[model samples]
Target chain A: DVKVTQSSRYLVKRTGEKVFLECVQDMDHENMFWYRQDPGLGLRLIYFSYDVKMKEKGDIPEGYSVSREKKERFSLILESASTNQTSMYLCASSSSGAGWGEQYFGPGTRLTVT
Target chain B: ELKVEQNPLFLSMQEGKNYTIYCNYSTTSDRLYWYRQDPGKSLESLFVLLSNGAVKQEGRLMASLDTKARLSTLHITAAVHDLSATYFCAGLMEYGNKLVFGAGTILRVKS
Candidate 1:
């Protein structure tokens, strides 16, 4: 079975603090993504990595960065935490095959910034 | 830019009823996906529609795609309390592996 695990299920941080959220997958997928889920905005992509050390910015990449140094690990970094950045973070992994394969998601991390 | 839209952002229904969630995309895409998410939980893969007229069913949920219309529908038959969750539909762009997702429909089923 494929499993994606997040570093923390809930987090709290103060403003101006630097925060890091980690994600690990056991499926050995080539594509990994980070998304933030808000009430009305739905799931907005923050960043994605297709290969180790290769990252791409998504629609809502501002104030967020990602690192993929290993195949099974992807990390999201918040340079400066703010109240507006408090949202549920999700990590997903998918295969890099020809067709559109389903993405497996982690349990998500709920971050609160004060 | 490709945009995905879903109708009826919130749905409330009683058990044993039937409902359909609609998802439309702004651009042409051959691959579509459906996902279900519980409150405070991550999303789970429900269906993947690859081509036009493609239909897949599992248990009480059925999903179909129409590439020409750029539309996909997730129809629920005999809904139950377990089916209460947020459903999202995403469109795979023609060029890249990025997926554009709709704003999800929140479903509530009452007994």
Candidate 2:
């Protein structure tokens, strides 16, 4: 089974603070994604990395950024955390092989910005 | 812009009942995915529909796709309490570069 792990399951931060969420995947997938889930809005992609050191902005990438310095590790950074940025953050990884194989997700990190 | 929409944003069903959730998209896409998310948890992949008329089933859940109509359906048969979750269907746009997700259908199965 593919294993995706996050650094923290829950986190609380003050406004204007910097926050970092780390994700690591056991499988050598080529694609990694960061998403935030909110009630009713479903999951919206924030950033995605297709290769090491490469990144692309998704739909809601304004207040967020991402880093993929290593193949197995990806990190999401909040420049200035705010209450509105508090949401369940998810990390997913998938192989670039045939059929766009299923993206395995981590348990998610629930960040609460106060 | 690519848009994905799911109907009946909320569903309440009884055990031994059957229901279907609808997902519609506004662009040409060959890949569609079904995912289930429990409260306070990340998404779990349910099915991947890669082509028109493709269907997949697991346990009591079934998903099908129709590229021509830009639609997908997730059907639950003989629902159980454990089947309750928020179901979302996402369409791959930009040739699979990104996934556009629907608002999601929150299914609640009562005993």
Q: What RMSD value applies to candidate 1?
A: 1.1
Question: Could you give the DockQ of candidate 2?
Answer: 0.66
In terms of docking quality, model 2 is: medium
Worst 10 residues of 2 chain A by lDDT: A95-104
TM-score of each: 0.97, 0.95
Give me the candidate number with maximum DockQ.
1
Candidate 2 off by > 4 Å? none
lDDT per residue (tens digit) for residues A3-111 in model 1: 9999999999999999999999998899999999999999999999989999999999999999999999999999999999999999999888854456889999999
Cα lDDT, all candidates:
0.93, 0.91
Q: Where is model 2 chain B poorest over a 10-residue stretch in terms of lDDT? A: B91-100
Error of 2 at B32 (Å): 1.0
Instruction: Summarize candidate 2's per-residue lDDT along B1-111 as a digit string, tens digits.
Output: 779999889999999999999999998886899999888788899999998999999999999999999999999999999999999888887565577889999999999
DockQ of each: 0.75, 0.66
